[model samples]
Target: MELFTLSLPAAIYIFVMAYIPMFGVVVAFKNYKYDKGILGSEWVGFKNFEFLFKSETAFRITRNTVLYNIGYMALTTICALAVAILLNEIAKKWLKIYQTAMILPFFLSWVVMSYITLAFLDHQSGFMNGWLSAFGFEKIKWYFEPEYWPFILNAVHLWKAIGFSALVYYAGILGIDGELYEAARIDGAKRFQLVKHITLPQLTPLIVILLILSIGNMFRGDFGLHFFIPNNSGMIYPTTDIIDTYIYRALSEVGDISMASAVGLYQSFVGFVLVIAANFTVRKINEENSLF
Candidate 1:
């Protein structure tokens, strides 16, 4: 009774914020008419989903979305784990300072980050251009070029996101028993050996869990990073276009609520399946570590 009472607020919050909106998934299968309303709309079966798959932007956006997310998952996991290990080795005096500096960027709004990105990449008065021109090199328009965006976006994503991911791994490290480390040291294990055996093994479950969550969202791009960092330059859309950004543009420009809902539903369904599959695989390997 006590536990049920404690969870009542969270249940209400989820019902209000999360589960309630799930009804909108029906719009994905309907030829939604605003005047007719959601329930009154005519069912269209898979027609809306067909439009998404057949559209020219479909392949490009889907490709970019999946590829970018895969790259991010790979890079961020490796980098964050490295950073977390490094942080774990820090002494008490400097650990607090290091942690504060690392987490500061995670708290900044993407809008603020957009401006910061613009300041450095702005064509005429930007820091990069200024430095290049000072060295007698011709100034390049950063936003106009699509070639540089992959690296630029990845770097910015790492900068903005690594702090939080690193902290998660840091917490995972904290949960590890100190006795393992002490035993390693008593056995004359070197620092690198201890990390290779003790730290990495202990962190595998957390790493796998995070990886599964990341894979579940593979089709969903970080809209703020893609939209804001590139400043929505049409020329760079070839490379930077992702499902979320594409859907946002469709929503803002065409006001196609049905299409937007369809895309979102597609993403959700795929994510749901992937998460289930991932959890199942985890269960097969180690039942206790499975999310369910």
Candidate 2:
């Protein structure tokens, strides 16, 4: 009875905040007239979804979303794992200090990060152009250049996110049995041998779980990073635009609640399918590492 009482508040919160909002998912299928309300509106079947896919920009946004997310997952996972291994090798006192400094960027919101990025990337009075002029080079407009955005976005995201991710990997590594390391050392294993033969194998399960969860969000790019960091520069839309930004622009221009809901529903549904597919493949390869 006491445990149930302790859990009641959280149960109520989830029901009120999460489960209740799920009913609004039906709005995706409806015409969603303001006067008619959600259930009273006309059901338009899959027409709303058709509109999203038929647009000329559909391929571009979808390609960008999938490609960018794949890049983030691959690059961040590699970097985080490397950092975690290095952190594990460090003394505890320095580890704590480095961990705190590394995670400070993760604590910052994307809006704050946008301003920080702008300080460095801004054309006339910015750090990059200032350095270029000092070196006898022409000032380059970073914001207006689509070609530079892919690398810029990836770098910013890695700076903010890799620390937290590395900490998670480090925690998983710390959970590994110390006696196993002792045994490996007594067996004449070198540093690289210890990492390759022990640390990585033990960390595999956690790595697989994180990778699976990240794959589930492959269709949804970070909206704030793409939108705010780019300052909504239209010239950079070719590289910087993604599904979340595309949906935001569509709703802003047309106020189509049904269409917005449909696109959102599509993202959720495809992400669900991809997660299932990825887990299934992983399970087929190795049941122990698979996220069930």
For model 2, how does the per-residue alpha-carbon lDDT over 109-183 read when each residue is reduced to its tens digit?
Answer: 899999999999988799989999999999999988899989999999999999999999999998999999999
| Leading candidate by lDDT | 2
- Regions more than 4 Å wrong, model 2: 1-11
lDDT of 1 by residue, 1-292 (tens): 9999999999999999999988889998898998999999999888887767988988899999999999999999999999999999889799889888988888998889989988999999999999999999999898889999999999989998899999999999999999999998999999999889999999998998888898899988899999988999999999998999988987899887888888998898899898899999999999877778
Name the candidate that leads on TM-score: 2
In model 1, pairs of residues that clash are none
Quantify all predictions' global Cα lDDT against the true fold.
0.91, 0.94
